[model samples]
Target: GAGVSQSPSNKVTEKGKDVELRCDPISGHTALYWYRQSLGQGLEFLIYFQGNSAPDKSGLPSDRFSAERTGGSVSTLTIQRTQQEDSAVYLCASSRDSNQPQHFGDGTRLSIL
Candidate 1:
């Protein structure tokens, strides 16, 4: 893909179930980010991975959320013990570096029932 790619455009799961979302960044992008956006709310940063450096997970809202970037190309975000409040659009973005402009994927819409 020319741009960032995300899988499972929509997800519906039970409140206590877990879900994993995937993202494939551009070929040479060194920075990847995970964000969540609730209805009518702005994007909430979740985590960031850059090259071989450790990931910055400071923006994660709770222990239930976690993400990993493998081989500096693919990333996955996992949400455990999901709750209704966790419903939102999970977005993935990539950039050449921290200071570069990011290209975003369409996002995976998650709905907790």
Candidate 2:
């Protein structure tokens, strides 16, 4: 029940709907990252947070995708107006620093209809 945990291991949503996925990172970890892996694709970084470092959302596919970290520990990723192209395994990881090897949790499989 430690390390990292993600909610709604599986989510089914209709296209154009909004959904939120939560991530609980390891205690005391200062770096958190959001990534998504589509079928046969490498992990794609969406955003990252480390201490007060500004988050990098350059990898976010669209404005519909956003994330926020709270207390520098828990984070939530929200996808608005989800589309079929957004369907993928959303993964969350955290590390001691941005350059550290992030520990990942079983991702939330989002299916958009």
Strongest candidate by lDDT: 1
Q: After superposition, how far is residue 105 of candidate 2 from its true place, in Å?
A: 0.8
lDDT of 2 by residue, 12-46 (tens): 99999999999999888899888999986778989
TM-score for all models, in order of appearance: 0.94, 0.93
Residue range with the least summed lDDT across 10 consecutive positions in model 1: 51-60
Note the clash tally of each candidate.
0, 0
Looking at model 2, residue 63 earns an lDDT score of 89
Clashing pairs in 1: none
Off by over 4 Å in 2: none
Clashes of 1: 0
What would the per-residue lDDT of candidate 1 be over residues 1-113, giving only the tens digit for each residue? 59899999999999999999999999999999999999776889889999745468998989999888889899999999999999999999999999999999999999999
